[model samples]
Target: MSLTGGSVSVRHPAQHRGRSRLSPQAYLATTGRILRQLLADHRSVAMILVVPSLIITLMYFMFQNAPHRPGAPSPFNNACLIMLGVFPLIVMFLITSITMQRERVSGTLERILTTPLRRLDLLAAYGTAFSIAAAAQATLACVVSYWFLGLYTEGSPVLVFLIAIINAVLGVGLGLLCSAFARTEFQAVQFMPVVIAPQLLLCGIIVPRDLLPDWLQWISNVLPASYALEALQEVGAYPEPTFVAVRDIAVVVGFAVLALCLAAATLRRRTP
Candidate 1:
């Protein structure tokens, strides 16, 4: 309310609202702001940079003493390769979901949406920032796994890194989409089991997806993580990027794009 003489005046919340266009200036500003926030949070930085390597280190010790048969690969190394992809995806998903939820709960997202800023710009800015974090996380993890843990792959490490980065961005997209349905940070956390658990169980990591029932195979076919794991497996089995590996990577990138677009479509100006 504004005082004019002895009277009070009120304005409608939507009075000044208009269709916000995408602006490079606004997008860069938002991206820079979020990047600064991410850097300032030491815990998040550690989680993104340190936790994956630590987990790999622990796995190394856990399987160091296991008996190995002649002419066989280390079980620990095999598991590490799988986890190299899984860890970044899960970690990125958790961080992105909770962080976005916090913005809504704290009214930051609401206030921003009220401005002349397009939803796509906001979501794209968020994607770019988290992707940078994901790249750093994947790089550190790959270094620890390949250099320190002796994790071996038949294919080039560069291809593995490429797949890892794509999976991390996939997580970011899904997390952004899921956050739209959550009312609180806790609710966002709850979505992990709902969104990720099923994929883990059926992503051909535990059991070969093709060996499972027809219905189960069909389900696995639809999950993006299944494609990610398949791509990693192809890399492990081949010395170069094969046609199948390239196809899987493309599928994952498509899914991530779809998820981000849907999230933008569902974005709300305020929490209800």
Candidate 2:
């Protein structure tokens, strides 16, 4: 970047043959900057830390009076376990996407890219910061559900919290990828219905995958959210994480990694 008269222009980073090496200093600096920005926003902080718990609390009451089958878990308990994963994914997706989009619109991302920061460095920084926020968000939601809201799972609450954190990180990855296609914050908001809602309906939270039509089942099989819901369901049914549950957790992690790679591939030093 240079100044000519009163105008300043950014010189885009030259294309490299392969992925740029991530620098420790650049990664830490970028991560610190993004973390600072996130902490500076009170609204984002509230949404991240409180919204999932609030939603779970509301669901608890809404189903409080519903009938319970004699031998099976109450509907509220089942739904609460599944939602513990979903809410984080949805909330983080929205926050991360919008925040990244804001950085792009403000030219902060471009300026940073023009420096020694590789795309991977910037993305990893965003991931690390959001992952920390996600851990807190998942922890609060799990604590409230198990202790305050009377949610119970056959498996350990620790497993449930871990799944929720993974789901939240998955959200962060998808959000970053979506932000690349959105020119404005409102456009990023519009992506929730397109990207998240379908997953919600199809993830076996609303209806069991076995009960769905064969084609819908096939589609659900391909969505990352389905694996998350399945993992939670396994945890609910078993006292320990089963082989299926472990496999499902691995699938969610793989999908999150894929989304992050795609997001990095989509990054541009300058929007055109």
Candidate 3:
């Protein structure tokens, strides 16, 4: 086609095609591939699901003899809540970021992008696959905490399990986002200190937010883990769900969605 006077320009048919809509089949295929890879890696499977439970059990025994007032909150309960909220975040973050970095380095992601796969489909597939593992991990942690460790909760154990899963998913989202910036597995692992350590310090896990300085408290309020820990605490302390508990859950979910969207947007088809 003549553009102006003597210049001829042509548009490729592929360029004319609009953005591909997400396909469930493609998403499931990607998810299944990831799940199969994870299953084959026996070490990863144990690290993702089993190690956290073992750690929680150790904590239970360590705190079993701690002194507590008759009406005061139990140290064991607080430790269990912290384990549920933080353990999955740490494990899932390491797994997702390192796995994604490996894919990027191996040119697998570039090859996948050459196909008709949408970025959102890939991101959702990672999220879904890790979420399944996350759910299993959370379940194991909760069961061991409740049965073996003798964790007593005023609220439903089901609620604790649900919140723990959400927290794990949040880690997956953050891991994906962080992976875009990492060129090596070491860099991905380094993100734990830079991205997650601060949250752990400020998320009321080690020290209660109320006891923190005003500025630190403000920082804590913005961190998603803070809300997760808060929700778990509420569930342990209250017989019925309270408004604060629901609100904290919503905030944690919102953070997870926001992180995932950022991850999809920032993902590159190939490493530079």
| Best-fitting candidate, scored by TM-score | 3
TM-score of 3: 0.93
Give per-residue CA lDDT, model 3, range 101-210, as digits (tens).
99999999998877677777788899999999999998889888888888888999999999988988999999999999988889989999988999999987778899
TM-score of every prediction relative to native = 0.91, 0.91, 0.93
Candidate 1 wrong stretches, greater than 4 Å: 1-20
Error of 3 at 212 (Å): 1.9
Candidate 3 Cα RMSD (Å)? 3.5
Off by over 4 Å in 2: 1-20
Deviation in angstroms for 186 in model 3?
A: 0.5
Q: What is the lDDT of every predicted structure here?
A: 0.89, 0.89, 0.90
Could you give candidate 1's per-residue lDDT for residues 45-164 as a string of tens digits? 999999899989999999999888876878886888789889878998999999998898899998888777778789999999999999998899999999988998999999889888
Residue clash pairs of candidate 3: none
Candidate 3 stretches with Cα past 4 Å from truth are 1-13, 16-18
lDDT of 2 by residue, 184-268 (tens): 9999999999999999999887788899999999999999999999999899999978999999999999999999999999987
